[model samples]
Target: MYRSVGLMAWKAVRALAMSMTVVSGVSGCAAVQPASRTAGAALGLDAYYTQSVGWAPCEEGKTGEWFAETLAGVECGQVRAPLDYRNVQPDGSSGAQTVLLAVARRPAAEEKTGTLLAISGGPGQTGLDLIEAAYPPEVLAHFDIVAYDPRGVGRSTPLIQCAGGLDPDLDLNADDTEALEAAERTEVAACVTDTGLDVLRHTGSDEATNDVDLLRAVLGEERINLLAYSYGTQIAAMCALRFPANYRAAILDGVVDIAERPNDMRLGQERGYQATFTRVASFCVGEYRRDGAECPLGTDPAAAEEIFQQLLRDADARPVPVRGGSPVKATDVLDASYTGLLWPSAWKPYLAALQALRHGDGTAVRRLADFQDSEGTNALTAITCTDTAGPDHRSHSQTARRRS
Candidate 1:
């Protein structure tokens, strides 16, 4: 199902790319001037839109070490956006609190045709890392590839943090609603205390979309080509809908259906993960048989799923002990498997990790879980919870009931 959706998305991107190529050829590349103060004044965002961005080599510790290594030659800068756009004083005065967003750009290798704004997923992932890891040379040759850390995310000011980070030992299968609720309340309080409620309140997708437009204006581009993945697809769709004129074309990869209810979306994700795991287990058995080796998951697919389930149950009953770290919980195993499934390259290693766990060696699985949970902050939870409206107690109760 995901493969077909990905194929369709690729086709759409190809069609849009062809059209953009023709448009660029006909129009020709020209230096675009920064948006005029008068034009910005009309929209009451003159201060934000007209601010100058001083691009320089990303500093060693300021923009992250990965940025320096992966995005060599890329320039980094910052843009000040209102903490709350709705509460802007219109004069760009001191009345509105601001957030400093980290921005990066790799200049076109050849003549610049236009600007391509890339948005990463996670809502907490840094866009600079996305461009460095995913973008190819052909893309860099045609357009100036740009990316930014959305407010409250990496490199952005007023970052969301929780004391000691989120608990790594959380047992998702546990039916202690009171304990879970207490943990959630404590986490929220820490985030609010550390990052301010105002910042957290405005870090939703809607505000992030506004920040993208502010970036567009700051870049002096009349319209930008967009490439968005996963959770970013929600922001991209909102940008296209709210500010239609500001985008030339958009490609939404691993598209998220924003119209779906949040609870249903989460349920669908779990089902997808289960299906993928079953397929992987089946493949593991076949490959092992071909190689005259025993498969840890056994030959039967259903039985393999049961084996995985028992591992989770065992982990929940008594966490899998690691050599140098805290024991791994059932949630850790699930998280690590989900993260591994995200990349095709990790599938083989993921199977090996599962085999290791079956043999009572959980070091590999623990490492995978650590990598997935490495963000060590509550930015993802803050943004997602803020974006989703209404109380979700019904879903929470349903989940607890099912688990119980």
Candidate 2:
């Protein structure tokens, strides 16, 4: 389960920090020249994308299907880059081919502050969508928002491939774990090694940081404002570290400390779960006491936890039918509970889920299961795994199963 690290405390600290900073980072603008197709050296553009993905223009009220679609009043374009950034013209035709997928939006009004580049997370998550959503009328009135998807990601060519099937809806029983693990192992081997070690090697915080500088130059911004989330924070931090001059300020949500990298994600998530369990249990206990009927739990919270454990074990053996679609399994239950950890808003749904599980009603439980499955995209996993230093071909299926 993913968890926020000290949400209450961090919110206070972040609020204070943000208050100390000025609201507007871009101001007092002089007339700027039009952007050039070629990113020149003067703007500190070291790399260029030679390929691009198309952005279907936004209609009156149409939403971009995926994250990278262009927003209203925004122009969408694609930039192509080399599969290998180091050697741009690998084929010797015209250096190597490189594409940078880009989405830029501005207010319908003429006058605007500047462009604020919005970056998304998952390393694989589409940053373009964030720009379109975050840059509503209020923000758009001030600045044009630009976002891009990195290589091997959304709309970016040569997508990373995981050998295993990512059918989130599939129920993974003990009988299925072995097959699932094997498939995952196969998929990982294929996707990670597809570009060989070079691209995979370069696909870290450092390279992404450098890429931002190139983007800044290509977009023709003297300095850019950045709003990033989750893994996007890592990319922004890298950009700041490498090209501190390129940024005015950055707003980071679900921020990740660069130094923490991969280790903190799992450990921090576990701590967050432990805390949520405490909060959720309190809610359950309070509700049980208020109802006073049979009490949700036979005895106290301790007994309730025991009952929950029993439910999980039972679910593992055989799925309890819910929603008329399929039965709810332990894995489904785990995923739903884990999804709740992503945000405080999910607490209510989680509460409902627990009640449903208690009564053997699988519909509510299935909803949670579906939410969990929704997130199990192949791209997210690839990006996460690639960010780490490990054997691209190695499979942890056996280990994962043993742990389970």
Q: Best by TM-score, which number? A: 1
In model 1, which regions exceed 4 Å deviation?
1-17, 21-42, 59-61, 64-68, 164-166, 286-296, 299-302, 374-377, 389-404
TM per candidate: 0.82, 0.67
lDDT of candidate model 2 versus the reference: 0.55
Model 2 collision count: 26
Pairs of residues clashing in candidate 1? none
Best by lDDT: 1
Model 1 global lDDT (CA atoms, 0 to 1): 0.69
Give lDDT tens digits, candidate 2, residues 228-337: 66677777766665555556666666666666635556677578677777666666677644665333334466666677677788887877877667788788777777
